[model samples]
Target: MRRLAPLILWALACSAAAAADVSGRVSTAADGVNVVPLAEGSVIEVVLTTSGGEQVRTFAARDGAFALAGVPAGRHVVSAYNSRFVFPEVHVDVTASGVQAAALVFNGAPIPASPLVIRPAGVAQYYEARKAVDVVGFIKTPYGLMIAFSVFAMVVMPMMKVDPEEYREAMSSLRGGDGGGAVEQSGGGGRSGGGGARSGGGMQPTGAGAQRRQIRDR
Candidate 1:
């Protein structure tokens, strides 16, 4: 019975030590030093890879902090992502006592005492989601295309109108002159009328000419 008691006590201690926590805060690094919490109502998820299998835990951040309890102790790779962007992977060697402090930053700053792992999954998922959003936002549906075309017509189409100088030259060429064909015809008519008036005056014999001929006969 004494030997059995010692064995049981050792087993319980081992069990308790093996079950440790992995917890941390998620933040955005600004100016490489200032830290800001993620947007309100955003989703936070952590992916932990263990020898047994991959474990995923998702939770809403409260005051920009998250905690995973009872994480199996081992060498685990931690990958975290949100609806908008993903943080770089954090690698931690989980021992009998677990990783109690972990910080994931999106700002590309160095974290002290934290193993930074290369991103293999979170970045791919983030880009895929962003691509899906861009596709839907631009040309995924008829309405989206319609909106795009409408914007083009309203903003860009007006800029494509004929140039003012080119337009004036085209109209002048079509009319055959700068003042148009009508002005040419009107000017020709005025010249012809002047010639006719001079001829008519000569044919009528002016009064001065008649008076001079009568005085010469006297």
Candidate 2:
């Protein structure tokens, strides 16, 4: 039993060292080379998916560092997530020796010299920004100017006061004179009896001329 005790102890030690710990940092790149850690109040979630579809999750600390302890020896994919930035998945291989992390893959292209430092490919925009209305710019447009003129006429025309009689007189004067002037000229010609009497005599053919012609024929 004493000889077998050393063998059992060695087996337990080997089993304990079989599982390794995976550690990495979450960072953001401004120019695609140098990386900076995430903000202090930011929450970053790191996920490790094993080859057998098992997942191990952990949150990054304030300094953007995270660790998953006792990960089984196998191949796994590491991904980091945040609300404002997009990150790429990293491939990692775990053995009894140590953890080996692959370079980050962004947009299907692997970044060179990139190790466990996870950086964002781009910023995530959830909503569009609201723009202010430009009053001057709108008024400069043809449609906007037309709308403004119509509104001005609507507002100002109601406030103006004008007498109906005065409006009618002014309109008649502007139209060359009062409408009664034409009627008055016709009445004056009738009263004068010069042109009116000649026109009446020419229109009546069965009067004195017709009677004289009948007497001569007899």
Every candidate's lDDT: 0.64, 0.78
Q: Write the per-residue lDDT of candidate 1 for residues 1-218, one digit (tens) a residue.
A: 98799999999888787977766665545334555455667666777766577784756365445666777777666676666555677656666565633334344343543322223222224233343347665686888889889999999998799799998899888877866677888999999999999998887768778999999999
**Candidate maximizing TM-score:** 2
Name the lDDT value of residue 177 in candidate 1: 87
* Candidate 2 residue-wise lDDT, 120-152, digit = tens: 778877989998999999999999999999998
Backbone clashes under 3 angstroms, per model: 0, 0
